[model samples]
Target: MTWINDIKHTLNKKCAGLAACALVLALAGAPVLAPAQALADVRKADVVYGQAVDARGLSVAQCPSIDAEYAFVMDKDGTVYFERNATSPTQIASITKIMTAVVALDAVASGAATLDSTVTVSAAAAAVGESSADLQEGDTMPLEVALKALLVPSGNDAAVAIAETIGGSEDAFVAAMNAKAAELGCIDTVFENPHGLDDGEFAGDQHSCAADVAKMAQYAMKNDTFRAIVGGGDTAIVVNRADGTKPTIELESTDELMDYYSNAIGIKTGFTALAGPSFAGAANNGDKELYAVVIHSTSEAQRFEDARELFDWVYEHELDYRLANSAQTATMTVNGARTEVPVAAEVPHTEWIDKTVKATLADPEASVRIFDLNGNVSQSLEFDEVTGDVKAGDKVGTVTFKQRNATIATVDLVACEDVAAPDLLEGIGIWWDRLFRGLSGQPQVASAVTLNETPLVVDKTAVAA
Candidate 1:
């Protein structure tokens, strides 16, 4: 009793008008003292990355050192994993065929054209000197057959045929290609021709970067038709002509990566003096698939080497979600009273216990980017002042994880415990907490009940006799 009296005496002297005894009675269950004014500002947790910051001591996959002037890697979801000189645009060589193939495929997808539709090879298409499909002028074959010629052999002639047949001209096809690249957010890309030939009059201007090329590859592979075509590396098929005569042609993949690498998939290859050597390729292992780009490598073989080195490593090492690092219970301010909420995912993160790199499924500051592969995934904090009662597991805020500014995952911040509405006395305590914190230069944010300040009566009922 003596000690309590002494404490009351000291509080009365410090807070001249606080009415210390009254405050103690009102705030018996009040939250810890913080200035309610501080709630006006937002609070964010530090989003830590790297091996040392991992909640669980799991060794992450190491990044491979690639030797190429331009290189980029991404997952199947267009999440860029890594890049070197990815922003600088350079002549893409045969990687240009990806856009050509996409436009042609879009035509088929939209019912504007079909695989069985005839494409009459003109002198422009047939007379292509570099990497020809061996198509003769005036020959007519299925558009599907021409695409095989274009993609498998990396034929400039097939590009011309697709452009002329589908787009009605090469210039128009190039325009469409540029439009598609722009639409896909390829800011540093420009298509001056359907074929990635640097030997043309505008050789220097026809270029793309590793990042842009990765986007094109990702968009193309999502389609079943395009995926099947590229996945089937080398094939021999009979191409029927308009006259009913069918000629058998042997189509070989120009991308050697598919030939030597176990799970390598076909994409496109390019080379010319200005562009050096380039390849946009893909690979798959189990459930993971990646799109890789290497441009301006020292030699043609070096491009494949760089791609394989990246693909094999990325596919083998993937990040998985583990348990939440933070506690399951969380506190929220409601109606001037403190409430608790329970949080959980549909499946316990422990399911990924067997994974190599375990990440948090709950309260993750940032989405694990899967080593250096899925570009950068980050989240913005969402904290707004809350009032009124709340139920357990009720959503309060969110941590939105994004890649390339596109939302990939959103973790709902929910209540782990219930917060009941405050009565009139509690409301006085809340307003008093805010007023005290304001006078003391502290955030009026409530954590636990404190009896240091006199209760404020925001409503008349708070002081009713």
Candidate 2:
């Protein structure tokens, strides 16, 4: 009886293995019978499956009561993960400081100004708003310190002061802000005032699209100085006094999301009767990070809630859209010789395919195209002889992935060499060809060539005899 029970258990195990193998073969579009037969002796096993969800299926219901006019959620790469009316222009409230901070930081980075340089507060900046940094007109402080006060405290006074220092006056600063926005590719944005306080006319108030704000944020975060300033909850600065009394001023961040969301990074928030509540929040969850813009919410809390929801959706679904079975290569010409360049992805290569369906590579080499950040064709090399060496991170070629004629994605190709040069003869031949090519009718050929035979040399004595 015991032997019979053992035989039954072994048969159950065999059956389970067969079922799992069958499922894998079906998903892979492989020969199903082979896997089924291989696993036929197995029985019980645990298996997991992934289901495909369409955009609409993943989208959350709109929040009507929040009174939001526009909202957007973007991945770290500036891809719009989700959005609603994100392109429409709307009053952005204090989020205008994001632009202000970016422009000011740009000035410092370009050597037009320095963060430690002092700017005397003007009577105008001192009186700009009720929430002043208490900066007296005659008082001065380092630009870096003032920026922290402006951003962290959301001080209207500090905004005007920084604007005056950078733009010569608040009005001039507003013009500069608008110009900088255009430079930063914020096409739908316009800034009439340095601070986001509502102007009587909608035109007077600072206005921007959610998408534009997200772009600006992405650019600003690239600046190490700006990133540091924005990521902090508060900063302490020394204020210069006329009476020989030094005072320390503490600036607190207005963004409540930083305090609540563990992964939340530094961004900006704004509010006004006309603009309502607006917030730009950035958060990083392990490998994936996202930015959320909530514009014109009924209340501050509601905007924060909306931003959180957007981040949650991003973290949950980011892996679903990644590239699968991706590969990269770099090609470069050395000394007029072409060589295969090796390349690597900045991030790990990964993809999540639907378990119900199988994906296959259509072509090995023609599937991708590569380009530089400026959209220039990547450098590629061809040679007649052996391929030369290439170093990692060296620009070699580009890969562009396409379905039919439409492009799906682009990646960079880099050299795998630590250091390399072209073959000696190839290098000399390249120079020699270039020197004579201008005089000859033959068009220039950029590809490298390998020589199979040495050129003949005449002997002077033999020629004379």
Candidate 3:
């Protein structure tokens, strides 16, 4: 198909002028349109709404003109707000460093490294790529400084240096990054380098989908150190060299959004000859944030434009398509006994359900056996049949929602009871005279029995049948 046709198919738009311009650029191998200019056009397009499209359904018309590849926009809650071919893996360019940053910060949080800890540069790290922090062999800097350079300048050298500092080598660090991606349920992502420089031979295996990148971005934003580094606009550091001379380097952010969008937070951008321009960016509109990923754009400018279009689209429409509150009520069965556990949230809770679901009862059946905190199944409890009054937070029962029969969502069966526990001893005592009069063989007097210096008096008599 012609490039124009591809653009038309990808964006589902019949913009003759824009399509012709994109087609000419693609065929001539020219740079894609600038993001700032494209976004100006998009603002006009938004006012000329074609129709009320279903937000749940995918639409190519909403996507901007770029090199056709995977793209997606996700909300803070992990719900996909917009997507097109988001599952397909593609050359992600430097966006891979988003994962690198997340893994580095995680290692630091785990005490594997510290922000203030200094790391010596090695020859291998210095040799990674053109986008470098200009480190010489044996040059040293703190982890926090390196991260600012790596993210802000898109420094491949800084990525390699940090990897080696934390994992002993870039190879070991890539392994840790991949392992962490897997742990976070990024199923379609893989990494061969800490810096995300494309390796031609392993192109197929060394890529991530747009959705996977969004997930990684989400994970990184949760770290205080990672957030601080990415959120900064620029950083200045003294670059120490092996020859005993130091040069100060001013690293500026590659994320243009930091300059243009008032609420823009920090993220990463990537580009290569083969991969084109790919970007993963996030912005906060109040407590709610949105992440946008665009892969394989025709030019660097186009990538940013596509990302901005996505951000603007989400900002305008996300609340309209916000997921409604969903709930699942389940019953627990053990030792042939059953109890109901209701699961709910005060607000609509939405999450990407990728892993196995699990549930545990706050109170398991007395007859049911489970392990203690130490992992030994030493205690057994019979299921207490739920009865009487219950309150909101009261533990009526415990339930775990499972995927592949493994627990994921847990909720307590709360008592609806709003009152205090009933007193059984305060009401009345039983009569002993009625208990003795019914005897057939002998008549015994009712008496209070006491011992150990306590007094007891009663009428005593013996009778034979």
Candidate 4:
């Protein structure tokens, strides 16, 4: 959604770029284009539940056999799940563009430029080409469109243009890229050019590794604009020439992971005689999201397959533990009501409890332990202060489940039944009784409820004792 606004703002500034073209093409009965088509293949994975596993003692025998020279699989939060030669420094080729995108977007966030800001393709940039975004020398386009060209097609030219626009020159931009890598704790990463080209004048001692690339991917994916652009399959972009000619350039995604894996999220792909075929792939299976980076794979298609194997292996073997169930009740005191009311999960459970046994509510606590394949998870409960009338199923609080400080889910806590305020006469009577009790030096009793105060007793029927 944020990316949508970013694209719209940029397009609106440049004569309604995509949206306007879509309309014109539609009226003329040409192929209609929508930006969202880029994410058409992405969908949430079905929930898969499994018992917890103690991954600390996980054996190498259980790991997937991948074909890459170097590989790393990590959670979005930077938790490493699998690695092979992950720290070995090697030429990463165009995967270096990931950092290039990060630096450019960082400038946008810092107000140095905007998505609508124009970038001129210098002759030096357009001439330093390999994989192209169809940008020609002196051609100009918005930073947003340029990013699609840079990322989707792994455009070397677009990367140079962006670096010059954002960092003033390729040398300066490369310095910024290195600084960003250092800032992100990427020890083995070094950048020589914005395009990640490893030949000619662009070539140097530049290199990175699977571990460092994964770190960059994790950081870059936080930017919605960056994520949308990489995941966007193929798109048409409009660029302007000084002579007043506007040409639409169609950029096709180099990433082929979506062809076989439905949950594949676009990140980046690269190939060079030196770096071989490399891919930084991402996927979200239900609530779990992971990033897999493979460098120097046997082939371009094989790189994607390697990532697929990593993802499939993780989902099949890793745990998706159930952390907490809301079917249980909580007790809370309503200040102006007759007594404390019981609260349960706003969402109902299919399993039924005992009919005869009274299930008294207790103080809210996280009694269940659930594990995500990535790591351990903890929970925190927050409840609203209550007063006056309350209705059944009214939201009263929230139960947040977190894994390694990252929120996994938040479920609403709701009242199980109603609690009404006392009538005027009854209120007066209660106040009088309280005053009498206070004068008599008698300790007042506040109403309370407990779920554990009564234990369940089961024979033929399940009920609380």
Candidate 5:
């Protein structure tokens, strides 16, 4: 509630005479001279996380404090949860390798190269050293192995070799990296070289922001090869030489966060005189995946710690909203059954709802109103038209839950009890009763007898005897 009031106060003070002031107020869920579209788009009545902000805004007040100069957190789907100076251009150091990986993998995806294709280590690449894969000039290895070298050790040499192998030259590869950044909407990123070694002679105007690095990391992680390489930690790679000698090179991941954090999956680490200590980290909590970037932290450990804290805070805030209960029942008519069958969910269903921010579903089946931090829930129930006998636990329908257009859970609706078809005389009697009820405008009563197994046939002749 304070955040809402804070927004109002800030708007009155900071947003005076802004053209979109009314729209900003609307997005803050404040009643003002807001356009219909603004109110409709931003007002998510009750079920939203603490002081939810618009997609473009940050909720720094609601998030954990961190020491990073710039930080950003988002889900795999690009839903922003928290940000601090996320869009400001700053030194990113080896975090640039995330985009380098994206460009190299894109080349592989486009048929310009293959992971198995050979990459020759050039003198320029081998000499441009900071972190090295121990690759010598003229040594060759598969692009896959080169990627392992590049990402695992944060190898500057491997980055240049990969650039040359894929883009024909380092300059051209740098150009491709810039183009890919633009394509990914990384507005605050630029690439001056294949490796982010911009501390001395390599330094220039090259820079990126937390938000842009997150985008690159998200895109690169989508590639299975890239994900495996970054998360591989310590690994051994093989390279071929002109003298017919093959040797194994052991590489340890520079991104050491994975060593301690159980949920830590990937990304990269970076540090330079200008960049300080930085990290792009990712984690998976059940089916929910999140990415966080921390740039210009105090130290190597602090970078990882900053990311861990952000992840911990964000994941802890996630809520499991119940969508379906197996004990709850609904009634539906089925063919040949004596009465309407009681249907219930086959299992209890709940969705991992992120409570740190409000997100929109891509497609919603139905919508419900709520006054909690869980956001709007959309549910849809589909029942199968049935006729005939049914047993308890027989699936008869389905219920699906969604939020912000993303499906959170789905469960099958099942019968709660058995229903049997009436016997010959009973069927006749039921028809007569139905006719009488229709004529009298009275309700038809369901047969009281429940068949445990199968109905028994009656012997009318024997009864007469």
Candidate 6:
């Protein structure tokens, strides 16, 4: 009775294996029964089958409602991941300081000014009210220190002073700002002043689109000094005088994103009766970095809260990165073997990301390509030259998946088992088999033993028509 039970289990196991093979072969469109000698080929097909089965399928990013009238979330390349009135021209308030900093940095890069260069304040710069650095008509500081005052406190005075020092006058500086805007493809942008004030005396309230501000912030991050000043904490700066002495001055950063939020990076904050509270901020976690803007919110806290909510929404929908980690284990075929060898990534997926992406295995030894929703190949994962003697736990390949061309996950493909070289006689036998098949006018590799080429009926199976 025990022997009978063992036989039943064996038959059940065979039935299960055949059922799995049937499903796989059906999807691959081969349709034919897997020949007895084709066991390894069918097993190697698991690599492709595993990927298809484990695919994340289609995903849609569900964005939450932003409290502000205009908002934008983007990558460094200005690829917008989320937007609400992003391209529509509207008030950005003090985020204009991003462009101000950009124009100032460009001037420094062009040798027109240096971080050490002095910003001699004018009556015009000092007189401008609403969030002033309190520059008395003659106060002077280095261009570098002025930047800290401008960005940290969203100082209107510092904006005008940097403009005069770098652009000869605020009008000329505003023109330069517009030119830079055009160069950066800020199609809906226009600048009326170095600061984003409601200059009722000039054109209309100084305005820009959410998308334009995102572009400016992304470009500004390229400057080393800008990155340092923005990412640093509540700071004091020393201004150099001609006599080789330094005057120490302290400043406050109103950017709550930088001051309170742990993940927040350096950027500018702005508010007014007309423009309300607005923020252009960036945050990073692992490989997930984002630049976002929330403009015209009712209060300061609301805009920051909006920034957090928008970012959180973006994070929740990122299952593509998670899916890659799930299927690191797979199988591959050896050239002359009848069984499949297991393979995996030596390193697991550790990047935090969410984007619609796909990967395709071109061939056994060829690299796998990752594609975006636009069907563009965003990244390619390549494997090392793996020979039959590869041992278990050997490093075989590496896969680094990216979103917007930013690496979100890096995994090391590894051998899951040892595959020793075939015996000499076994190699000769394989070569002779290939030679015989080729000489007989068949393929270099013969088809399955069950192929119906012989054209006969047996045991009630089909015969010639």
Clashes of 3: 29
Best by TM-score: 5
| lDDT string, candidate 5, 1-465, tens digits | 111222333354345467476767767975556555311112212112333354414233333557788888888987777677788899888888888889989988999899999999999988986677889999999999999988887888899999999999889999999999999998878899977877668869999999899999889889999889888778998899878899989776766678789889988988777887889999987757889999888777778888988887676655445443233233433364443322222221111111011111211112232222234566666655433555545565566666555676666655555555455776677677777778988745421211111112222222334
C-alpha RMSD of each candidate structure in angstroms:
26.7, 22.7, 20.4, 13.8, 18.8, 23.5
The TM-score values for the models, in the order shown, are 0.61, 0.58, 0.57, 0.61, 0.62, 0.61
Off by over 4 Å in 2: 1-67, 200-205, 320-465
lDDT of 1 by residue, 67-151 (tens): 5777788888765555667778788877889999999988898999998888887887777666666676777878887888888
lDDT tens digits by residue: candidate 2, 339-405: 5532222211111111011111122233222111111122122221213443444444444544223
Clashes found in each candidate (C-alpha, N, C closer than 3 A): 30, 28, 29, 3, 9, 3
Q: Compare candidates 3 and 5 on lDDT and give the better one.
A: 5
TM-score of model 1 vs. true structure: 0.61
lDDT of 6 by residue, 311-375 (tens): 66555434232223223334443354533322223322111011111121222233322222212
Superposed Cα RMSD, model 4: 13.8
Worst 10 residues of 1 by lDDT: 39-48
- Candidate 6 similarity to native, TM-score: 0.61
* Residue 355 error, candidate 6, Å: 39
Choose 3 or 6, whichever is better by TM-score: 6
Candidate 3 residue runs with Cα over 4 Å from true position: 1-68, 200-204, 318-465
Question: What is each predicted model's overall lDDT from 0 to 1?
Answer: 0.65, 0.60, 0.60, 0.70, 0.69, 0.62
Candidate 2 local distance difference test against the native: 0.60
Candidates ranked by lDDT: 4, 5, 1, 6, 2, 3
Locate the minimum summed-lDDT window of 10 residues in model 5.
349-358
